[model samples]
Target: MKPKYITLIIITFGLLLGISLLGKNQVSLQGNKELPPSQRKLWSDSSHRQIYPRTIQLIPQIQATKPWKIVFVSKDGLKGHQFHHPGNCRNSSWCSIWENAKQFGDSAGVKIELAYVHQNCAGIDECISTQVRLIDDLIAQDNIDGMIVGPRDSNLLVPVIEKAISNKIPVVIIDTPLNTTKTLTQVLVSDRKLGEEIGNWVVQQLKGEGKVLIINGPKNQYNASERKKGILSGLQTGNITILDIEETDWTKPEAKAIAKKWLKQFSDIDAIITVSGNLALGVLEEIKAQKREGILITSFDNYPEVKNAIVTGDISTTADSGLNSQGSLAVKVLVEYLENNQSFPSIVYAPKLELLTAEQLIQFHGSQKSKVKNQK
Candidate 1:
């Protein structure tokens, strides 16, 4: 045979062999008849199945646009968040949030709107309804990018918050932590520590031996409950006996009624601790009415009344959880997340606790100028 002819025959045979091997490896109907039964069965098994390298598709990053619109939902009504503080608009927690959000938005070229639960919250039910409606409406809007909600009740706001999360909207909770991690973040003061601070202060004042009373806020509220827990934990160290504990809605009338009943019932309340200054004032009125003097009163939220009380020896000491600072930081966190793609902490605690008393009145007076400077 010629050399070229031999090479051609060899190449043809090699091609034919390769094709036959490929057919046996596959279970295609067209080639199955060429393979043995056992070979066909093995080819159909998953071990012989087709395979490819796994791949992940990366999403393109979006540049944050200017004027990112945001909505702030406050548990309290718009008017309620406005306080008649002595020097600054910083007195109202909700108002402070609104103000700080606006300032942050202006600086960051973001737009913010404040929404309240209800102007007239006849009851807790109405408050919840109004808040739900407001938030749902805001979420439905196409222009809004995110939400900052200060929930009135931790549990009541869970559903709406989940709805926001489902819609891919980021939520930052302030003041009170809702019982959900679905939120982007929470801005809070250490409620338990604040409570413990007050409790420990009371114990020290009474020299670790006295009958103390707790005028607590709403029993179901997480912040209020945490404060109560902290107080109990702090009081655990001393010989102080908790005479009685009452849950109020942080309302003046309800606190007064509870105080009246307590005064009539217990003759030995060495000190009274209230979760809010408003409640403390209510209790103070009843005490005055009963002519009960020299009873140490400690309260939370250094409101104007509480400040005056501290100065005049009416309220021994009060805790101010840096309301304005909490509000300012909440907005700042949301802005950083939206603009810079920065991840927010699961829970962002606000600045440290501040104890307000008559001695700090001079420093408090100086705060007004700085507060005004920052607002500008």
Candidate 2:
């Protein structure tokens, strides 16, 4: 029921921390055993999994010797968009996508141009307008061969996407889901399935009978809606009663504020289900500040804050969408189509969801540290 604009101030100032949740404490690592060999192989800062899916047929050798020009449009500027840049000892899926795309593009002799929407530059509406204008300009150019974009708003960019398609350009959509299925390709995890996983985890933790609250993403966004639906479907088999659901802009303060109010008003809330770790961190802060205990929580995204929260017993569980694999694979698909005239499937699954608990977080961090030490 919270309006989107109410939290804009908090979100504009890097409050979301790149979809990262916050924790009050850090848990120490005590184990000497490195992450399992398989897990170590998959935990790269870029490309969570290096192995590509085996189903796609082999792409033909490149016929074009000239470098193809491709453009990538992201939701926000480089720093604000945490996906592409790896800082703070964390490598995000977006970073992996960009890194992989660049690496593959260089080997294939292609150029990848980055266009940041700068959504926060002026405001959401103005940022969108800028993106539209940029897309239009890019489309008008004669030599621009392809585009990869994730729109800020799902429906707002449909017309521009239509224009690109009409221009005979191949568009590979990544991250956010769009309404039209007409795009050349889409790269994202199954939102509904991820939501169901969270819901099922909650049901199991609570033993299927308790009042629950949900903190979801923006309204009507494909990913947000699908996750909401999945959570509801998963909870259907249980005796859980939904107390309320709030639509968030994926900011921490807004989520924390909402969670605080709900916690004060509803004493029977046994668990919290959030779509992103940003909201989960906010909610957890409220629970921690109030000294509330035994309320289970779950969310998506494996941001360090969320990982630490798991270790400190603030979050019950979380899921990772394998951003690294998704980014690299998307680029590979785009390059294959561009260079070899090979077409990719309409929908491709990057990798299965990697679910984690507190113990797993600790072990994962240990393995990362060990890997880093050996490299040094």
Candidate with maximal TM-score: 2
Candidate 1 residue-wise lDDT, 49-92, digit = tens = 22110111111222236777788887668445644332454334
Against the correct fold, how does model 2 do in TM-score?
0.75
Clashing residue pairs, backbone N/CA/C < 3 A, model 2: 47-324, 48-324, 83-94, 83-95, 84-95
| Pairs with backbone N, CA or C atoms under 3 Å apart (clashes), candidate 1 | none
Candidate 2 C-alpha lDDT tens digits along 233-337: 889878999999999776778899998999889988898889877788899999999999889888887756677788888898887766545655566677778
The Cα local distance difference test for each model comes to 0.72, 0.71
Q: Which segments of model 1 are wrong by more than 4 Å?
A: 1-65, 82-92, 366-376
The CA lDDT at 142 in model 2 is: 62
The number of clashing residue pairs in each candidate reads 0, 5
The stretch of ten residues in a row with the least summed lDDT in candidate 1 is: 44-53
Best by lDDT: 1
Pick out the ten consecutive residues of candidate 2 with the lowest summed lDDT: 24-33
